[model samples]
Target: MDRRRTLRQRLATQRLSAAPLPRAADVVRLLACVQSQERDHAFFSLGLRSRDTTYAAVRAAYDRGAFLRTHILRPTWHFVLPDDVRWILAATSPRVLRAMSYRHAQVGLDDPAHVTRSLDALGELLRGRAFLTRREIGAAFGERPGLPSAGEQLGHLLLLAELEGLVCSGPMKGVHHSYALLDEVVPPAPALGRDEALARLAHRFFAGHGPASLKDLARWASVTQADARAGVAATLAATPGALEEVEIDGITHWFDPSLPRRTTAGRAAHLLPVYDEAVLTYPAVNFPAAPGHPTGGAVDPFWEPVIVDETNAGLWRRTVGKDAVAVETRLATGLDHEQRALVLEAARRLADFLGRELDYREVTGGPAADDAKARRAAIG
Candidate 1:
């Protein structure tokens, strides 16, 4: 397929420009997992993939235990379904454990017995109460000799416990999210062997976010290339004709055989939150005739919200005051009257989602915050 068609097709398959996924859990399930490091923006990420899911609705589902927020895939927070959480943690924790080995030693949790004891204490504390905030859980283990303070080591310990399937995030308490025992929060799903877990995850990635490469899978999952290849091979074996390879501009891309080619209706404008999967999943996203956009993928260190017309047009940032939400948009190229109106409309939708009045502004620069003088010149 051509460049524009490629972007649209992927976006449609990803539920970005088509009939959105019906439920919040469906979004997480289809994408295998979602990058949710920025909690609010991650809600917006789910919103982008759904038909009519509100921020409140998404939060409600989260509280209702439809999905879980945990350290998975890459050590950052991700929204994973409860059924998948245990296996994903089991499949991927070795890598995370190895990476965090030094921190484990530094925090005096390097000993397996000590780790098990800590988990037992945590489990007992949570069992005493349905959901305990991290602070509350940490307070139980107060400052002790050779043991890191709750502040110093609670997060690490919690991560360790989570990977061990002892704890997972529970309902939110005001602004704070609490933790529950994995057994308490998640419904039982049958266990899978290591190979089965890897295959299922690989299938989800390819089926939901495909036209993806093994390298992309490795990078996204933080697994070795050999593991990625083995998982892909297993996926192909389990479901013959499920994956198809297409050569796009002399590069091979694998995608689900079921997705049909289609154009994205309307202006194709969106205000994607920081770390939205639309930007994170693919290797190099192509934009049609976008001279300002590079096909080789751009590194966004700031994790700014993106304005997507056909591709990554520019970056955006928001300031949420009590009564109003102010959004600023910087376009890679100038927008026409119609395009600008659509962009503003998208921003207004974001304001509605936040339950605040819109204070939308369009300025220019790249992803970075340009100087005040430069901003003035661009606007003027």
Candidate 2:
């Protein structure tokens, strides 16, 4: 199996290289979860994957509790649908809590009773109000000794409460995101059994982000290796013939059975948001880069927006002025007229989403050049 061919197939299957979903929540629900460490970018992440989805529309869905942002897999913030949030947390939070123990101790938050008390305090405080910003929540703990609401411990405390399903994100207040009690934010979603939850997760992972290996699933879901295998087994049992195991370059990988055949003759080049799952999920596979050497060192794959032509081409970023949004691209190599036009088309869509005029620019003599050089050298 050619690696680039496999990646292109995976991208098309994930809807990144095909027609977008119909709704913002649909995008989130399809992926099961989206890494949302960056807020405004996360909005664009959904918008870029949807049919006629606007920034305003995505924000509205978020405001309406159609999807929620909180710590899920790997103790990082992810955008998850309301119904899936409870089951995901139920299965994974214990592991996350255990992982966070050392950090909690480092910040004097290792005491379970004290942590419980803090969760109780935040729960009571949130019940009295519709929502509270991080600062407001911090103030609610107001000089309370031994409380983990000061310094960086504040975020940790909030994360703990989130794991326990006490609080979650509220609508943005201007530029600030606030928090609300999970119980009050939306009705309780039905829970799933542990085995069922793992199976469902395994299915979603492969369905939306597949052609992956057990290692990829474990890393992405933050589950144990044993659990990852079990989850895959359960998924196979639950939906026979849904997954197909294929050997790529002598290494076994699993993917959905129903991926579209290779077709990239006329599709426009795609400039995806930073940490887009299309690029993030398969971190182990280096596309448009050398095989067996995923991106790292010098080029931070998580930091820049990915440019996808046939495969991962390079990175792009945008700067906003009063009249227009200036899109600066640092490609690994040059593009043809058609490919450049397609990239521009993507940038135009982004400008439309932000209601800004477009000012496209090509950066020179910077990291893009260096990365291209490095890629060429690696391939040679």
Supply every candidate's count of residue pairs whose N, Cα or C atoms clash at under 3 angstroms. Answer: 1, 0
- Model 1 lDDT tens row, 1-380: 66666677777878877777898888898888899878888888888777545778889989988999987877878899987898888888889789989988897788887777777777877884479888876666775444334665678888888777788889889988788888887778878898988888777787777677777788888888899888878888998887887777776667887864454455557887887787677656544323343221255444354446565656667898989999987665645666667778888878877788999888754554444456577679
Write the residue-wise lDDT of candidate 2 on 1-380 in tens digits.
66877877776776766767798888898789999988778888898777635778888889878899988889888999888888899888899888888988997788778878888888888885468899887876887765666687788888888887888898888878889888887687778989998888888888777788888888889899789888889988888897888777776788877754454335766667777787778666756631211232135542364455555555577887777998876554445666667777888988988888999886543454445666677679
Q: Give the least accurate 10-residue stretch of model 2, judged by summed lDDT.
A: 289-298
Predictions in order: lDDT: 0.76, 0.77
Off by over 4 Å in 1: 143-147, 286-305, 366-380
Q: Tell me the deviation in Å of residue 128 in model 2.
A: 5.0
Candidate 1: clashing pairs of residues: 211-254
What is the clash tally of candidate 2? 0
How do all models score by TM-score? 0.89, 0.89
